[model samples]
Target: MRIVSLNAWGGRLHEPLMPYLVNVEADVLCLQEMVRTQGADADWLVYRDHGIELLQRANLFEELKAALPAYDAFFLPVARGDLFEGDRRFDSEFGLATFVRRTYPIIGQAAGFVHGEFSADGYGPHPRSRNAHCIRLFDYERGYPITIAHMHGLRDLEGKGDTPARRHQANALVDLIRQVKHEGDRLVVCGDFNLLPGSETFDILSSLGLADLVTSRGYEDTRTSHYKKQPRFADYMLVTSNVEVITFDPVAEPEVSDHRALLLDLK
Candidate 1:
């Protein structure tokens, strides 16, 4: 199955869609930053043409049941900053969301946490950072696990570079794996994991056995740093040792949000 994972930055603008979503194809898509910032409703109709059903926010539980009967959603507590009303924190606040296709029903759900996973107060900043961070999708139908956690790096990792928070995040990921998964599961961790391969943050996932699909295979979606002048940041789509890595590429679409859409095709 060619499962595509992408973070739509936030629900602010149009997404960098893959050709499969538009044309005739059957595939699974995992999107982060699908937030409902405004009132009760969000701009969900945008994905209608994509031939996929988006899981609505938790508030619309009844609507989800009546409308799409196939999928349901679970929200994680995301930390928000007062500076930016909609902007989320690095390690705190916000929650993980899931949109599962019916071919595989969601027989169960879990959060990849082990108490003080980040340990914000124990490490660097007291408040810690949080965004639409990350999540793991558990498919009981297939008895496999797909992790959608966001390994995000900050704007300035230079000054606060040597702190333990970053390592804590990685360590927490390792611990999460032990808590939420078994050896037989096929793990795919994808999101805005800030640092690129070889960086400390990357090492966190890599050291734990998650391989970078972009570098391992040759799916260079677009130029890096989609948030910068050249868009060269390595917001990755990583996979575990079990799955066969196929293509890892970021869509060459214009920046809909700050980041571009990254993809990973696994076998």
Candidate 2:
């Protein structure tokens, strides 16, 4: 099965991203930094690409649903804030989204904050509320159930180094995994972790018997055309021992978003 993960950069790269989604035949698509607005039409939201040019995506969730009609889409809001479109501000919901093919039998699902509580009134800053979205599905091709979890990790404005809250978030993530994961079930955990390699965050996840495929496979970068920072921050994809990884790629071409899409083929 082919599974893809990306931090959509708020769908700022919607123009190209739309085409990529149309042709990328993925069994499951996990995306972070997606936006959803109630009662908003296709042209309700807009983003500035690389903070230089304005871009608009009617409603990303709706657009994706149209593009991938056979996939079940789930969105869990972690932060509530306002997004500006021209001179107006609209209430926006920002969080993680997971889309699994309908052919897969989803037996269970769960979502909860891994960093902070829900910002019911409005969005907050670093250490702001963040969540992990998980789904357990029966993969008919493999004839076994696999639990997949995705998250958009805590963003620390000050730096990407270790912090107390981040450590707490890591522990919370492991806890979430333990809550829904079943015995002998294969596992996949991924997202834009906002962390560098060898940090305490990865250490915590490693304790759960997960392997960081990106670093272990000798991949050096996952940044896309939108990012222009040092250290070249990137996303990650980690899996358990039982998963037979046929192939993995942090697709650098296409420039779909600021973060490259992580594609994994499993047996």
Candidate 3:
């Protein structure tokens, strides 16, 4: 089985993102920073926040569903806000999404907020609401269940340091993992965690018997050339000890989004 996790950057680079989604051919795909605009006809929407303007796909969720017809897609919105098409305003949902290939039978699922609850109104402050989604699939070929969960972590304005809210978020993620995974299941957790390498989040996740594949494998950067930030590590993939990792690649080519895609293949 193969799993790919990426922060899609709201599909700002739609040209490459569209083909990447279709060509990656991952059995399971987890995406963060996805945008969905309901009842909009335009293909592009503008998102403006704190003087930062970005162009996003109007409804990327539906686009992915069309591109990968064989996958069962699931989306969990953390907040609802507005996107603009010229002067017209459209309501848009922002969150994470997971797409599983039809061959895998989804037998269990769970979702919960790791930070604040769902914001029905505009996105609040810097550290906005964040949530996680988990799905347990029965892999008949492997003869065992595989549990996969992902989240786009809370982004604090201050920095990506260890904060009280982030610590709470890590614990909440652990609880969510425990809720759906079974004893003999091969577990995988990943996403754009929005954290530093030395953060306590790794320590918290270590309690679950999962190892960080990014840092442990000596990967230094998870950001593409588009991101001009310093700490180029925001994404990670963690798996249980029992998982047979065939190959793990932090894909840096194609520059599909600002973030690099983490691809993992398992036996």
Cα lDDT of all candidates, in order? Answer: 0.47, 0.84, 0.94
Q: Write the per-residue lDDT of candidate 1 for residues 81-125, one digit (tens) a residue.
A: 111213321222233344455655443335544223333222234
lDDT for each residue of candidate 2 in 82-116, tens digit (9 for 90 to 100): 66667677677888888999999889878899987
Task: Give the TM-scores of the predictions, in the order they appear.
Answer: 0.62, 0.93, 0.99
Off by over 4 Å in 3: none
Cα lDDT tens digits, model 3, 75-120, are: 8999999899889999899999999999999999999999999988
**Cα displacement (Å) at residue 42, model 1:** 9.6
At residue 230, candidate 2 shows an lDDT of: 73
Candidate 2 stretches with Cα past 4 Å from truth are 41-58
Among the numbered candidates, top lDDT falls to 3
Ranking by TM-score: 3, 2, 1
